[model samples]
Target: MDAKQYANLIDKELQEMPLYVFYYTQQPNLSVTTIYQYLTEYRRFFNWLRETPKDIENPNAGSISDAKSNKEIKLETLKHLQASQVQMFLKELSIKQNKQSTRDSKKTINRTINALRSLFHYLTVTADLNDGEPYFYRNVMLKIPLIKGVKESISYRNAKFSPMLYTGEKKRKWIDFIENEYEHTISTRRRSSFLFNKERDLAIISLLLGSGIRVSELTRLNLKDVNLRDRSIIVLRKGDKKDAPLIADWAMPYLENYLKIRKQRYQPDKSEQALFLTKYAGKAKRIATNTVECFVSKYSTAFPDGNRTTPHKLRHSLGTELYDKSKDVMVVATQLGHTGISATDQYIQQTEVEKQRIQLDKTK
Candidate 1:
């Protein structure tokens, strides 16, 4: 087959492949969404190769004159791809011009690695064998090692703000005040909308603190996902096909109140199924994730002493609270919809203050 046809064929096979096959075959526990994403990335790579000139020395020679030509490029491009080239591509990505933050850069690296690994694995297993032997696809795999870097010099005077010395009671008090007093307070400037808006904010914060759901998951919530009678929400956990339990008994009352106001304000049009809505133009009809984030940020700023909180910080607080209260790794894992106990362990692991408290107890 020609290059374009081969690319199309691969895309088709990827799209048609059963996710359960991966579990029974080599890579068990690999999510279908992950596989799809890898395939998409590989397709883009092929498209780039097809468009790029084979010989950069002579740009005008041996190049497809018509931009509209949809014919497949040479198959040699795929065969010629080497480990060095792939490594160079990764390096280029690391230094690529973009607005990505440190966290986003890490995520991009991870995604790129996954995509490259998936492609190479597919080629090794499914494609023709090289040298009549199994070609292990290890070259594309990330070779990350935890290397210790130079430690920063610290003076005794500079070493301050130790977690063991810092009492979190004051911080907790501030958080409590924000939740209890500042969160629900409303102004009379807009009488008709005041109660509705306040109820919405309360429900939003309550869900964040109570269920510890990610902002993305919270935004995707629909009326069907909610179980008012059971006081549970069906949250779409990462890598899961179906929504799982994100129950919060405390959040039910506020949710109910919000729902009542929501129903009254925006009587369900055919397109409106989301739990939240906004009054802004273009978004007047549909609720979005950013809207919820902005709402959370606005109220978070009301706290005295400039305590900067985000929707995600509320999730962290919930996890911290659960860890402190139960001290059970499995319980926290289940509550947070985490696939394993290790994630929960990270949340509950004793801080310096907790360690100091233990030491004080031993002295006592």
Candidate 2:
């Protein structure tokens, strides 16, 4: 979804949460996606507080499930929570298995901790009560530590991702497969839908691999954002910062092919300005980020050894490919609009890591 859609969802969440949460989520420069994530974490933590048994010593704290809603729970129950209880909640999260039946990763747990920390910080240091004082000086999240091995996790992630990249000749081959061969693999009933979206799908994946824009950035593009003569597209980066990234010459034909038919194929309304269009109820709408992810996953999984990768993986492919050509981290960082070279550094490391993995396999 776009930022506007997420903002609408955030407004609904605020209705169920405390007034303090509204202030917290409204702070300037916090992306709508970030605000939505914080609200999700808050809901999960609140549900845990409500379902857990009442404490023996805290007899008056029977407000657990009796409270009508999260707002009441936040006001009456949150203020009385002990640091031990917060720690126990983290412990439960550590062992909890998701719908996929896999334990939460340290990174996932750390995100929860960060969200809770933001809430507590807002309550303690930011929000002012009716009496012109902070909620309660005690912030339980301060006592909860984020999981360690974050640096190790980064390297581990790069190693796992290195083999999945569509670098070198593989990038062209992947795009060709989608354009020419992908229809044969699906059922006849599904082929019509597949053919209907063929050019649009190929264009989306090509742009991602060619320019390294985030999926969110891709979904936000309007018709005017594309500069055919310049071979660049303007994108809103993280924090709503705008930058124009050059598109690879090889990917331009797919983009042209899609644009030539976009109006006729989608029958977009005159007011519709989205660069990519999706038809809904016979009306054209800007494509959603989730829809982009779903199609990227589907197409990539069909390609040989594609491993069901994400758009972000395609982003890494572009980063590494640029690094290989320019042999400059600074160029990759600028192309990817990374604020620092730190993240761009990983694209350089991926080659060495892949070599070491190959050596280990040779030894085996």
Candidate 3:
């Protein structure tokens, strides 16, 4: 979703303080998606506090009022939050079931911690309240630590996804399988829709593998962002950085094919600036992130030696391939629009782990 969509969602959720609005909108660095996520995390923590009121105390030795709604929980509640209560919230998050009914991962828990930390940091240091003073002098979040085992989680993900990634020969064959072979594999009922969307799907998957752009970047892409002559496309990268990443020569043909027939096939309104469009309920709208994920999964599951995968794995395929060829972490980082080499460093570690795994398999 775009900024407006995310803002609308934020409006529907609890906006307990003007500080919440300022935190999300006034900050130039936070992406719309990040704002939405942080708001939800704030709500989660607030709800947890309401349910576990014993965790809360009035700083002035006064009784804490029962918060009938999330909005009813005033700023003073956050000011007096203790370290132990925050720790308990993190523990609950670890075992919390999402809409998928699966327990939250450590990453999710850490993100929640990070979100709360941002909020507290702003209240204590950033916000200018009455008399030019911040909300509170004590930041409880400073005492909380993020969950560890990040490297282990990265290794686990690398091991599981490395084999499924499309790189080298697999990259070319995956696209080939989609064009010539995919239709034959699906049922007659599904084939019609598949054929109708073949070009757009191919372009989407090809772009993902060809350039290491995030799924969010691709979904939020606009028609004017593509510079075909320069062999690059401009994107609003994470942290809202405007970047133009080069696309692979191999993926150009698929993109070109899609461009030639996009308007005719999708019949999008002239005012529609979205680079990719899907026809739904007789209206052409920008292709959504979930829609891209679904088709990517469908195609990968049908491909021989392919597992059900996400657009991110396709990004990994590109990143790993770039690192292998250039043997330079900086180049991969630039292409992937990573602010630091740490994330790109995982590509190197993942490849090393993959190699070690193969050697072990050979020994076995």
Candidate 4:
């Protein structure tokens, strides 16, 4: 089939297939965005196949060709992908001479590999009996092994050896550090608008720190999700599941105050049911995730020690704090919407043993 026809067929198949069935049969908790991304990636692979030389005997292999010739190629094209080709791709990615950090490179490689794997897997399941199914086609691409140097750096970068939980004396110091720098400034039109919406910003920060919510989840929150009387918010956690829980005591007052100020600042349009809105935009629009990150970074800059501050840092801080307080692995996992306890345990295991030893010396 031609490229356009091929795409139309794929789209038709996707539309006919129930999304819920895909979730249940394949990735049960997959988000709609994730599924859509996989579909796009798979489409790109087929497009690439349509252009590339199909036969091993063809010396001019790897070159793009006309679509009409693609159908003449044998179905063995799907089964004959070499492990060496994948390795070459990885090598090219690693040495591409970009300014991206090691973490960014890792992310790019991981995403590309996942896209490739999804295409191959889809072919294995969907292709007809006449298609030549090779042995290697069944083996999913192995996860890239972390080099020792990369692994060690990532371990340290994630604060796998932090000295203290973010609570008690540490929490007090951090809070004092933040509050002291909280100058109520209205320097520019933008600043004035942000200042006018300060209460909402504060509430958002508090909730982030308290709940360990992802930025996307924070932006998607609506008024109906919050229960002021119960001091809880109904959040759509990962996998698009509704889960309600109590707001941390520290965050509740801030939210209440923000709601009061929000009522006075702008009239909510009929379509605007979101709890948080952009300060400069009309109340009909919700605040963007990047706006929330920018605000956090702005405040974080006020404190010299807050160099690593971002929306995600608040999540890490909460997880670290919870682990320190309760020492309950499952509790922390549930709070952070983790599917399992291994994620929470990593925080616990990463606690600096040397720091604990030093604290023991203080008692003497």
Best by the TM-score measure: 2
Residue 350 displacement (Å), model 2: 2.1
TM-scores of the models, in the given order? Answer: 0.62, 0.89, 0.88, 0.71
Ranking by TM-score: 2, 3, 4, 1
| Pairs of residues clashing in candidate 1 | 4-72
- Regions of candidate 2 where Cα sits further than 4 Å from its true position: 54-66, 74-77, 96-103, 128-133, 149-156, 353-364
Cα lDDT for residue 326, candidate 2 = 86
Candidate 1 segments exceeding 4 Å error: 1-76, 99-107, 120-196, 241-246, 279-286, 350-352, 357-364
Per-residue lDDT tens digits of candidate 3, residues 1-364? 6455777887776356344445435667777677788888877677676677562454444323358767677777778877887887788777778788988898888898899888888788877754687777889999998888546567777777787788988888888999999899889999999999999999999999999898999998998999899889999886668999999998998899999999999899999989998898999988888889988998888899677889988899898889988879999999999888998876887667757878899986
**What lDDT does candidate 4 reach at residue 46?**
46
For model 1, residues 1-364, the per-residue Cα lDDT tens digits are 1223444654574553333222222453444445455655555455444455545577666432223322342323434555555554555556756444433255666676676665555554543345654244444344432223345432221132122111145444443654466635656554445444667777777787778887767877888888877777887677654556665675677788888888676565767777766665434344556667776676556655444567766776677677777778777777788777876644554333467678899986
Candidate 4 regions exceeding 4 Å error are 1-29, 32-79, 98-104, 126-149, 153-186, 279-283, 350-355, 359-364
What lDDT is obtained when candidate 3 is compared to the true structure? 0.82
lDDT of 4 by residue, 252-343 (tens): 88788888877567666777777887644443467777788887777666554545467777777788778777878888888888888877
- lDDT of every model, 2 decimals: 0.57, 0.85, 0.82, 0.61
Prediction 2 global C-alpha lDDT = 0.85
